[model samples]
Target: MGGPEQQVFHPNANIVRKAHCSSMEQYRQMHARSLERPDEFWGEIAEQFHWEAPVKSNFFSYNFDINKGPISIKWMEEASTNICFNLLDVNIQKGLGDKVAFYWEGNDPEDYTRVTYKKLLEHVCKFANVLKSHGVEKGDRVAIYMPMVLELVVTMLACSRIGAVHSIVFGGFSADSLAERMHDCRAKILVTADGVWRGDKLLHLKEICDTALDKCSKIGHNVEKCIVVSHLTRLSNAHTQKTPGMKPPVHKTPFTPGRDLWWDDEMKGASNFCYPTWVDAEDPLFMLYTSGSTGKPKGVLHTTAGYLLYAATTFKYVFDYHPGDTYWCTADIGWITGHTYVVYGPLANGATSVMFEGTPFYPHNGRYWEVIEKYKINLFYTAPTAIRALMKFGDEPVKKFNMSSLRVLGSVGEPINPEAWLWYYRLVGQNKCSIVDTFWQTETGGHVLTPLPGCTPMKPGSATFPFFGVQPELLDENGKIIRGPGEGYLVFSKPWPGMMRTLFGNHDRFETTYFKKFPGYYCTGDGARRDEEGYLWVTGRMDDMLNVSGHLLSTAEVESALVEHPDVAEAAVVSHPHAVKGECLYCFITPNEGVHFSTTLVAELRKKVREKIGPFASPEVVQHAPGLPKTRSGKIMRRVLRKVALNDRDVGDTSTLADEGIVEALFSNRPPEASKLLKAC
Candidate 1:
């Protein structure tokens, strides 16, 4: 019932690309053929790419049963391929070299750059040679910690060209978070930048990298070299732009003479010619991590051939991308969405993808519309959070710009709220572009459930149907499969090409976390409902996690961060309803016996969480409690805290609590008092 006024919107023939199937019947036919004859369907799709060798089978003999034995899922087992060739070389070989590959618009309007397939290939080859010169080889892991820039794209492709598995930690992550990821992967080489522009603030990325490297070295991760890109012109006097109100920082990045190298210096010495390294289909392409329920994040491992095929296929079908059309997905390279959609998918399809290194409301509220008009972007993919943020500025800013070039619109990261969905549908799309509310996760390399813009009929809040080769199911609390038209936990019953191979260095955790829950099916950890006609509506996460502004943040991770503060004895973190971010974190802390709770203490604790996790995980409400409601076994009653955070009068079943008095004590000092305290801080 929470779904937006359910209205069925069919495909608009005027906006839909002609190459895509125009009806649901064609989609159903293709889906049926994909499930019934996978080899034939996927084989035909694979033939569109340049594979070094043909795949003999779609999948090897592997059972999905977790209880019976270990689940071994492998796709394209006998094929040999290279992702760099498909993304870069193939387009160049087909005479699309001169066509624009990436139109990079920097944070400041004065800064801009464009790269063609030919130029991109040359940069990739040069970087690949640079990596080889530094002893990087196949199976070696390289760590990239950079902001949204063209160099990040080159680094990813260069790693792929040389068969090195690259792990890109988002630039916004804390040093501790970056160190943990680097240590987990034991990266041989590290790539970073001196600084990055984020609105008015310049993030000193080199300082963070230095701190992470210090920890990595201590943990026995012997990173051979660090390549630092001097990205900020303000760091040097000669290139600095003197503005009336802009004040640059005085911090200078230190360089280690032998161990560290300049990006340009290394590129200058390296030759712009390197062959793509052919790898087996099952070889790992990249490793990405997701916020796990536990304190530690899980490193999701995605393989080469299957992931590439799935990414390209979904990009082509979901957006109905054509040869000359331009596509733009405004996501950073840190997340899986950016890795799959922004880089691999669009490039593999040889589409002109916009790479904007700024926010939607940067210089103005119509920045996105301005770019759409400037580049004539045919497809615009973004998050629901961004849409909601823009909605706050009203429709006038959007009306001022021309968005006529947009043919398809997309929503990702989290489920699109009904109100935000309608605004995006009417204002940005002008009822002409089809809105694809995509639903997937970091574990799934590409979108699994979404509307094929040209084919499926879109409902405002629903992610229309499953992509080809995906079989979804709804399971009740007792693990019984719910039939049609019901609400339950979401689970996948079949193997998909883009699925994660395992959690890096923790296959046991992967098997237990995802497989052990449902035995045979992969647990999505999300609650979902299917309409009578079988359209899926993601009902948010069922775990102790919150999708705050489309970024996944775990409650346990924040709790861990809060407790790391010496004054905090214990903490309970929960999500409360938020208008814009979907959910915001609220913390209830029981200080150490003698420690006092003050506004300064609250500010320090918030900073602690920001440094320990990331800036996004900082709790909006930090309530000081004498003690948290806990059971005899010492489990904090998070539900009671959650109820208090939401100001709900009905506190469910306090009879089982070891300390019932703590509930009243906690609620008496809830967000109203906490908000006053936070405001003072």
Candidate 2:
């Protein structure tokens, strides 16, 4: 399916006039310079941060061609720096210590906290000392499994301060998922919370930690220490009335005599000052595990200096951030987006960020807008899934709030559909704010293809162009580059500073997965097409492309068409094994609130897809779903949908799902008509 070929919305004149790169010509010139003179462009940007010893000779070197040498990429090889120091100390030294670092919005609407740069440094130092007292030295792995609390951010920075590589597992992950990650990383210590309130439910995190540790011990991978933060107790102390749908917070959690320690007790005796551990630029900063095609998760590792520079640079330009802009990225710290935007990138730039600890639907549908208005948030970044979900509630919830403070809006996690983009632009932004459709992945530390808010004109469903130094090209199946206006696999022709160093402990897998595909290009595993305007459109994952009776179709294109039907809130398109047509589309759709799913609705959805993507792309089975299974990060679990469509007994891992019950619900809620159609598969 083809993407939008022409610009739909021009950048807001007011924003463009005040932007860092005020004109398209200026942006083009800077982008050209970034590609032509890579070392000079990046070296100048790197100088903005503090480095112990700057690179004297080669700033960067890489060999994507595995045949020429072992696949390698190194940046600022001779430099040494501390990410924690640059993010905190540098900003403090610049007299920004009294500025709010993070505005924490807790699950309860009344519960909130403002942490300043100096206060954050004190917390980080205290936590670093706590880790040190527990024998967590440099190079040791620390697994952090906690909710979206202020302490979570502090723990990450603390790990960086002590030169410990942190692997943050999402709090919603099951004990098995936690155990697997801890085992893979061979973590020496695990930091957790007693319990956390998500909406109304209180998740006993310390109990989950205990179970994970037991599983790890059984597997001969023992985590020596577990530090527990009493988040629930703190919440209880803050509010006299208990939150609805949640039981009163427990006074204390079950603890082990030798291994378990309390966060409050440790901080009582811990010093508020600790020295930053200087690490090589090439040293790993964090390893975030992402789901792989093989059912196992891949630990995507990002280095210090390069990742910091790229994240900070992208944050400044993509969001058009100012010194006092109140930025908020609604993502959990476990994900790469939160690492780059919510904590590291914003802090490194000395920007105030919002760290929310709840869902969009909780308390009310207007919760997100309420937070925005309450904080007067200037730059708002969130996933398209959230946008679509909120769209189901209609515009009243959003229209009631004052979003006048919003200057720039951002879409992440997935490619946004035209309908959702228009809604976000018209309703939430009031047609004044610029929308930055960011496209990147866990492997890429920062944005790859995106529109600079104030520079590039917005296209409803397009990523627009590549970020600085990101040379993206479309490559055909035969390994030949598709120069212009063609559809093929998306790959980067050259390496950027933010690219992942390697899959942790799996250099061969990294080489084969990214480099072996096209020989000399870093494979993005995504399919895309370039419009006549040279704007790139990421269709979906390459595997999501289906060949229906020799007709190639992208699932994203089909889903977008289905969602345009007005009655549908969200749709996930997957393929089931077919006998006649090589493969047929199996669609699971969640109807909008107050809209009932009926035979008429199903037929209309199929006709919508046919009209948009041709008859071959029409879904054979349209299953009515109450909800689509999604990870806590709001990414739909398409793999689970594919397996369920095939009626496969082995549905793989459900541990990472935000709501495991949704899987069973999808199976049981399959309409009879859908079952009849699915039989042909």
CA lDDT scores, all candidates in order: 0.82, 0.90
Task: Compose the digit string of candidate 1's lDDT tens values, residues 184-232.
Answer: 9989999999998776656788988888889888987868899988888
Clashes of each: 0, 0
- In model 2, pairs of residues that clash are none
Instruction: Give the candidate number with the greatest TM-score.
Output: 2
TM-score for each of the candidates:
0.81, 0.97
Error of 1 at 264 (Å): 0.4
Stretches > 4 Å off in candidate 2 = 1-7, 241-248, 673-681
Lowest lDDT sum, 10 consecutive residues, model 1, at: 233-242
The digit string of per-residue lDDT tens for model 2 on 1-681 reads 444434478888899888987777888888899999999999999989999988989999999998898988899999999999999999999999999998999887888889999999999999999999989988889999999999899999999999999999999888988998999988999999998877777688999999999999999899999999988887776564544555554566899989998889999999999999999999999999988788788989999989988989999999999998999999998899988999888988999999999999889999999999999999999999999999999999998899999999999998899889999999999999999999999999999999987788888989999999999989989999898798999999888898899998898889988999899999999999898788898999999999999988888988888898888999999987777898988899999988989989988998888888898887888998899999877999888887777666578778767788999988887667556656765
